[model samples]
Target: MEDSGMRIGEVAERTGLSVRTLRHYDEVGVVSPSGYTPGGFRLYSGDDIERIMLIRRMKPLEFTLEEMRGFLDAVDHPDTPGARKTIALIRAEAATRLEKLRRRVGYAEEFLRLVEDL
Candidate 1:
């Protein structure tokens, strides 16, 4: 809607996120408007877009909404400590998902074999 400050649609287009998802992020306190438009529309800034992009990519990494909030919080609040805590959180969940996927893939493979026999 506005080039000076990208509106929600432009942000969605640029970030490959749906407007609905952006609103959900707002409600979830994941990301919010830097300010409003002359017509009272939400206007996002470059910083907001960057954060949303990071969140977008992190989703498939299996980071929960709350964990994402934490990551954002950590980003906001820098730390000199080792990455053990962050690694533990992401890795444990990813491993869990990996195991679940292995089971699902195994089932699909068996199903394919049965289909071939039929």
Candidate 2:
């Protein structure tokens, strides 16, 4: 309930991610909360919320948790030489995923047409 941070439930409501998903992300080292309450409740800062939003954007493109973590690390340390390469790799992967999604949408449209004809 601090002014600078919010509890997990509030973050979940704001981010449209479930509390369980947030906990799992923490457990897996994807996007951990900034701090914890005296009672051990996770408290997330605005930076943490923004990090979670970035991860959410990657999820729909089918990025694995590890991949998401790598992208976040690259974003945080952009001055590192390897960070540029990592980001390029992520962009390539996203492009590939976009192509696959387009193909799937085409198949779904064909399926809808078949259903309409039946």
Candidate 3:
């Protein structure tokens, strides 16, 4: 079934994805609209909405644009196994980032304590 062909604003609101992000996605060949309005506004279908949501969730996990491109490209395969590999990679990367953040937080706390001693 075809969707109502949502405008860019609607897509941004619905997916919690900024319009700029959507445009960037389009520019990077990540998630593109199925059609366009007369004014060249991107029009998104239901599938595009799902893809946008997936990209939104993945971004916060600290997935770089290059990593995202690789994962998105893997989806074009005839099989669905790439999802598992993608998830595994995200988990590992997120864990590493979390540890780095924890170290930064500890350093910040120490700095605060030292400042209070003055």
Model 3 TM-score (2 dp):
0.66
Model 1 residue 52 distance off true place after TM-score fit, in angstroms: 0.5
What residue runs in model 1 are displaced by over 4 Å at the alpha carbon? Answer: 1-3, 80-84, 91-118
Candidate 3, run of 10 with poorest lDDT: 72-81
Candidate 1, residues 1-118: lDDT per residue as tens digits? 4536888898999999899999999999998988887778898888888899989977766678988887677677656363457656666877887788778889999999999999
Q: Which stretches of candidate 3 lie over 4 Å from their true place?
A: 1-4, 78-118
lDDT of 3 at 27: 96
| lDDT digits (tens) for residues 1-118 of candidate 2 | 4435899999999999999999999999999988888788899999999999999988889999989999999999999879999999999999999899989999999999999999
Error of 2 at 6 (Å): 1.7
TM-score of each: 0.68, 0.88, 0.66
- Model 1, CA-based lDDT: 0.82
Name the candidate, 1 or 2, with the larger TM-score value. Answer: 2
> How far out, in Å, is residue 35 in model 3?
0.8
The order of the candidates by lDDT, greatest first, is 2, 1, 3
**CA-lDDT, candidates in order:** 0.82, 0.93, 0.81
Candidate 1, 33: how far from true, in Å? Answer: 1.6
Q: Report the lDDT of model 1 for residue 20.
A: 97
Candidate 2 — number of clashing residue pairs? 0
